[model samples]
Target chain A: MAALQSIKQNCKKVMCIGRNYADHVKELNNQRPKQPFFFLKPPSSILLPDEGPVLRPAGVNMHFEVELGLVIGKQVKDIKAEKDEDALQYIDSYLLTIDMTGRNVQEEAKKRGLPWSIAKGYDTFCPIAGPIAKSKITDMHNVEIYLKVNGETKQEDNTELMLFRIPRQLSDISQVMTLEPGDVVLTGTPKGVGPVTSGDVMEAGMRINGKEVEEAHIKVE
Target chain B: MAALQSIKQNCKKVMCIGRNYADHVKELNNQRPKQPFFFLKPPSSILLPDEGPVLRPAGVNMHFEVELGLVIGKQVKDIKAEKDEDALQYIDSYLLTIDMTGRNVQEEAKKRGLPWSIAKGYDTFCPIAGPIAKSKITDMHNVEIYLKVNGETKQEDNTELMLFRIPRQLSDISQVMTLEPGDVVLTGTPKGVGPVTSGDVMEAGMRINGKEVEEAHIKVE
Candidate 1:
């Protein structure tokens, strides 16, 4: 109920979901996953608010993916979603975050059957906004998320477009790794994901029921 | 340094090196990587000392890959390892750990270009022993590591076989994700990796200069 800020410190692991949106999957020419495709970015990759510019590493094609972040408030494991709904209880709050990725490096790793750590685990790779209390978000399933780079809108979509929604994502992940208090899960990004260059000012936010609730601003350097 | 016995509580992330040994690369039919191949396992996956049996999930071909774990003692980033040295200062201690893997799950994920989170990150997957102080380890690069399933040797090798040794591993990793105190690096596994079934007892240990230092026992259930 208090201001659950200090995301950079409270967070442990950043669990990420990929290919959860149809259009986004098509844009990347990836098969629509029958199950949730998961990966992780280290907490060291987090860049807190006012932490300064996000470094665009040399020879890297950095891409921006804005998504809803679920902050786990309790320790839960083996949560089952057996045609009923009990998975939402694990989520303490929500936030807006950018799952910054090094596209070129990621492609190479994928082709070689290697891990995607370096591609997504660089310092300043993950940037976040408000820990909008669970009480504030009326319906997380229908919330709107969008991203803008250099004053131009690039990605704009609603959570309704997500292939594997929040409850399923949380339930599935909990079956493998225990979700602890402060662990954050980045629900997959939506369509219109694109690249960001140095000196680019990127802005992203979340809106629930037409009310702007959370926002994040990051500059590339 | 005091006894850093509570590994599960103290650790934040487990950075694992893949394809770091010539024989291991050849055994897995993987090409030698020009650069370090990295991935991560969540802290929740850790099974501490005296913790019960390591659960082998149903339908999963759980395999054991014994490795030397390096515990980072200092916060380091962008560490440069030239022809000389200096990377060893970051390591606070060492340990023996089994990087339990779901071979079938991993193979499916790899073939599909998916992240190996679930394949390699199930609960009770990482079983470790000893935070042998850095002072006790005369030479981390030359120590021997071995593993036995049901009292039969499966993997036995020296750290000297690692294609990318410690200093290089720490330096290269720091360049991407800042290595914080208590963070661990599982310097890849060796050859002779094989599947472990239920009712199997795994005994693994480390030897420095032919003297036993750390040993871990895990029972499969």
Candidate 2:
């Protein structure tokens, strides 16, 4: 029998960015897009109550790519990219997400025409940290998402530089999917995404619009 | 507060195939994998209801893909490309699913190195037909998944020519993500994927092993 269900911090889908940061784009030698780019990660990929070094699943060389997140409050669909504010009628709040990737597997898989899911879809691959209410922020743009290892910042970038702003991307993204309440859209990351060995203590911080809201930390085994 | 819930056919993830059918590989001039290839379609993509035609959301070239689905019965990870029996043991049941696609959006999105959730993760994109018990199947290797429009079969293929058998593909897919109860793994469709226009009738059927177990038909509006 199908179980009845309701929303508890209900996140409908987790969408992510690709090559949004210029340095990351330059590092990738890729051109900017006329629109925002996206991919998906299973919600099961979340590592809640996370502790210690996260277990990297097999079949991919998982890497860490930190990013800003938008948690939608209502269903938004079919909005034009240029007029993203029209889609804002649906967004509820925001979040912080880590889009862990299996880089090697992805390179190989895409080359062979396979989808990147296996390379990125394992459980605990997408570790999310916050859903701070929308009212707590003043600037959605110009916020910074940074990562640190044992208190040493490793990667940092401001939302001001995103190739596609969150509101615009949200509008574009909603055109293809009906983002229900709680769905998280991980806006692309800034450069400095690299490999992390086991035994690393990591902290990811988010500055919504401008003010830092939350910081999530964990240690590697 | 979180909704108190129990899962029914609850799967942590649902991995799908872009083109696992032999004719499909041939048509695209793509070589079939000795190992089965898979991708992810978040649970949010599913349109679960009595019976309906999954919508072709805006800004997408939504296409239709017919597939036989495997439901995991046990938790499994790191399964080999060979161990057939062990692979079978990991599965709990089987179902028939229609993997709806936004073909144009997918191509455009990927060319930008974007993720596919926008193209594939739209709500109601996944239309499932059954939860047929494991005991009902006759032959996993030779069943047929047929897609028809207005009572004409547009896609019809026997599992015989699949590059990778179910056992092998399932095992390989589990290697990256731990398969949990109710999770689905779609064994690819055969050649003959085409577009579906409005006002069309779509039906999905399966011959588990050999005998027909479940089928559903819905008209597009």
Candidate 3:
């Protein structure tokens, strides 16, 4: 698959999910939110897609979350559920994402009910996998997230268990706003989330149709 | 004062506040939210620390939101309200922020419970003004936001009227995610919001102690 135009070589917005899964929310002591919460990470936060080393942040407790990332090929917005075909009009494209979290920071942010920008929006916080064709995937609604730290499985989940499904979120998010080309979406992360530290090599990848959409190894800097 | 190290020259995140003001909430037909609603604008959304026109994307209905911005000086987490003063121990400085919005996208995202990165995070969407001292500002709790478009006054409010307040938000946001230097906190816009079109010019600035901190002019692109 060719690289999506916007993310091919332009600025990308890393749109990510928070508390989209019930158990993850419970683990964090957060009540299931009425709405699916989202946050942003700067494009620079990304590791070059398909590259390795996971690039962990040193001196602090950091965690890993592997997610099914969807990159819009074209701008998508205000999509009606009935406009499934029309909704495709707004998809920028598809991609993979590693929504790394500062668990310590996340806990504090949730407690304050403050916007999680400061805690989540770091230069290397949002990492991408590849530009996959949305049509190539059979089940956009159901997908698995696999994360391993130093060859140990830490987090693994599927999209079906998400508190809010993708199409619904796409329509809901787009209605109030526009989803542009190269804009990435973090569908959500599953259970078994854990922490990583410096010198700890971690690999996270997502497989769809027996292909890896995301493959990354994080190393502490 | 010498420029504080707070402004990360390469800022990755622009965290924002929505309906932070009571009257502003009323203007939007919203009751004051129990929690302070926030969103993310990518670094591409930023203009500069000084005055400049926030570029308006073609064909979208965009609006102006005058806000105060803070530049965190260090990596901080678990900042509690009581320890906010300690949180200040890490902040390098603050600036004034103009949170430009794509009204349509924001509302749509809010309704669908999707993230607002797009509506808020477009290139050059976040305009900053007045570089001030982190140690200089007497109170992040109560600063003033004065805004105008094409020479017409649009919004005027004091941070004192904010429901969540600064230290509280700082503590809360820092706890959820780590805040690094140059990451900004846009305290949210006040009321009297409206749209601007191509060829419309926006001029905004802020003041502390009767001195201008920073200001900028934005023209639709």
iRMS (Å) per candidate: 0.9, 3.0, 5.8
Residue A161 of model 1, lDDT score: 91
**B31-90 per-residue lDDT for model 3 (tens digits):** 687866565776555666443455566656788787878776676666776544765776
The digit string of per-residue lDDT tens for model 2 on A57-80 reads 544466788887776676656666
Q: Order the candidates by TM-score, highest first.
A: 1, 2, 3
Q: Candidate 3 — which residues are off by over 4 angstroms?
A: A1-39, A42-221, B1-8, B49-52, B209-221
Q: How high is the TM-score of chain A in each model? A: 0.94, 0.85, 0.83
Q: Compare the candidates by TM-score and give the number of the best one.
A: 1
DockQ for each candidate? Answer: 0.77, 0.43, 0.16
Worst 10 residues of 3 chain B by lDDT: B1-10
Every candidate's lDDT:
0.83, 0.66, 0.64
TM-score attained by chain A of model 3: 0.83
For model 1, the superposed segments whose C-alpha errors exceed 4 Å read A1-5, A82-85, A214-221, B2-5, B82-85, B214-221
**Candidate 1 local lDDT, A1-221, one digit each (tens):** 32435566667789999999999999999998888879989989887677777888899999999998888888989877542136567777787889999999999888977788789999999988777887777677788898899878899899989899787888888888888888999998999988888898888877777777744334344
For DockQ, the strongest prediction is: 1
Q: Write the per-residue lDDT of candidate 2 for residues B1-221, one digit (tens) a residue.
A: 11101122254467876556667878756676666667778765666545355776655676788888787777677677464455667766666777787888777655544456656677677777556665566466667778887788888888777777777777666666666666778787788777876667777676545556643333343
